[model samples]
Target: MSSIKEVSLRRATVADAEAIAAVRVEAWQTTYRDMIPDTYLDQMRVEDSFLHWKQILQALPAAGDRVCVYVAESEGHIIGFASGMLLPEAKFGMQAELTAIYLRPAWQRSGIGRRMVQKVARTLQAQGAESLLVWVISGNAIARNFYEELGGVLLHEQAFSWDGMDLKEVGYGWRDLSVLMASVNAMPTSSSVH
Candidate 1:
């Protein structure tokens, strides 16, 4: 069995776009197998996702932009990634949004996700963000429970349209960055390779 000591997290660079996209596609295929339409999932291509992420990561951050991307790795191989930004629209006073997070199936439930999120939160807080929010597909109970376990509170719900299908999305909010930062800091650092 793989241990957390084998994993490390760091800022993602442009060269990582392809690996990040691959993980995104694979994770979506696995996690959203029944939650999303087969047609939509079938059309998800790594090349397309690579181009999208490359463009996003290549763009220069504007003034006050706190956009960041972090990748989790084990023995130099990318396993998971997360991206976030400080959004203008605030919900429950959360100015930061977790735009995307994905991990290969084999890497899930190993504390990597929590570490990645905490790192993102710390980066956002340093950029002057006070709170953060994440939106998950309503039926994705695994994600919902993960957020809840991290002390997130249900903030709101909205209708999302994808491939002509209407879907419900639930938003989870963390009103205090300090609380999250402290919790992350309290975790045993020895297990983290980085």
Candidate 2:
């Protein structure tokens, strides 16, 4: 395992699609193994992930949504990643949802995840978001704790179908984007008023 001290965060590019895919696959297996079906994971293919990553990197976000991808690199190799996007909503204000965040098992607990998340948050704030959001698997204590430690609050609980099975997900929200940004060493500013 590479040393976490070497990890640094930066904006991802279309050229880094493959590296992002690898980190996604690793995080999925480790983070969602229990939440998702074993059969689904067993049949997962790197090619599919490659295609997905390419698409996300190549396309622009739709409607009210915007995406920003951040990668953590160590010695020129991507070791972790996070993707944040604005969500379409009617009642809530502009929200930056942490669609994905993952670090290699060995890199976990090394502040790499926090750094990756901060990159996304800062990017979103720059894009004009006032709040950030994340949904953790109901049973994922590690993720729940991580979000809480970062000052996220449980907003609601919802169940969704994935791979033909019911899955429980709990929404955790950051009421103050400024507070969340502060934890990441960011000096927060209000996004553009629309």
Candidate 3:
């Protein structure tokens, strides 16, 4: 078992697309099991998403742009990632969006998620963002609780369809980027490595 202490995070590059895609696909399957349609998860392929990830990484943020992606790695393999972006207009009064954040099931609750989120928060804060928001499946209690623990407030819920499955996504917002960043920084990543 790898300890959270073994993880290292850094900005992701185009070369990391495949590994990042793999993590996303795997995490979605593991984390969203009954919470989502099995067909949606079953059809997810790292290879199929490889180009999508490549395009995201290939598109470098222009001047004044806030889009960013960070990857968490251990043993030279990418284990997780967190990505965020700033749209041209604010939605739900939040300029920054936590576009995506996923980790292997085994990696959750080990402090790596906090570390990845901190990187995203710092990126958004540096880009003059006052706050950020993330959308999580309404049925994902674990993810919702994690965001709540980090000072996110339940802002709203929007109904959407995924692979023909009706679902509600809850919006979690942090009104202050600094508060989120500070709270994440204050967390102990458990230095005792096993």
Candidate 4:
């Protein structure tokens, strides 16, 4: 495994689609293995998400839309990533939301996730967003704890269906970008927001 010191974060491009898809699939399989049905996770494939990420990276955001995608790389391999946007309507009175964040299981707790999140938060904050929120499947204690450690406040929780199974998800919101920014900044570096 590569050390965090070798990892770097930057905005993603279309060429990264395949690698990003791999990371996404791997992350889902590993992170949600227990929470989600085995059939769903087992059926996931990198090919399935490749075109979607390709389009996402290639398309230009429409007028007044703010979208950001960042990736964490080390040894030329994409290890983790995050995507977020300025919300058209506020949830928990926050103007931005972290739509997705995932890291290879090996990279977890390496501070790469912190740096990736910082990039996303800073990017949205620059786009005139004052606050942000992320949804965590309620049973995902690891993720919920990570968000809480970053000063996230529980804003909402609701029932959601997945593969015809009932599940719960909770929202963790940061009311102020500065607070989120500062909290991550204060932590030891070697990282990303993922």
Give the per-residue lDDT digits (tens) of candidate 2, residues 1-194.
44335556777777888888887787788777877887787777767898888888777444223788878777788888888887766123436788899887777776667767777887788778888888778989899998887888888899988768788989888867888767755423221101
Model 3: residues >4 Å from true position, as ranges?
Answer: 1-4, 61-65, 191-194
Separately for all candidates shown, the number of backbone clashes (residues 3 or more apart, or on different chains) is 0, 0, 0, 10
Clashing residue pairs in candidate 2 (N, C-alpha, C atoms within 3 angstroms):
none
Please identify which of the two predictions, 1 or 4, would achieve the higher lDDT against the true structure: 4
Model 1 lDDT tens row, 1-194: 25546888898888999999999999998899889988899889999999998988787254234888999988888999998988878866889999899989887877788888988888888888999999999999999998887888899999999768899999998899777666665655444546
Candidates, ranked, lDDT? 4, 3, 1, 2
Displacement of residue 25 (Cα, Å) in model 3 is 0.7
- Alpha-carbon shift of residue 171 in model 1 (angstroms): 0.3
Clashing pairs in 1: none
Candidate 3 residue 97 Cα shift, in angstroms, is 0.7
lDDT scores of the candidates, listed in order: 0.85, 0.76, 0.85, 0.87
TM-score (C-alpha, index-matched) for candidate 2: 0.86
Q: Each candidate's root-mean-square deviation in Å?
A: 2.2, 5.7, 2.3, 2.3
Ranking by TM-score: 3, 4, 1, 2
Off by over 4 Å in 1: 1-5, 60-65, 183-191
* Overall local distance difference test of candidate 1: 0.85
TM of each candidate vs. truth: 0.90, 0.86, 0.92, 0.92
> Candidate 4, residues 30-98: lDDT per residue as tens digits?
888789999999999999899999998887355234998999988788998998998889887989999
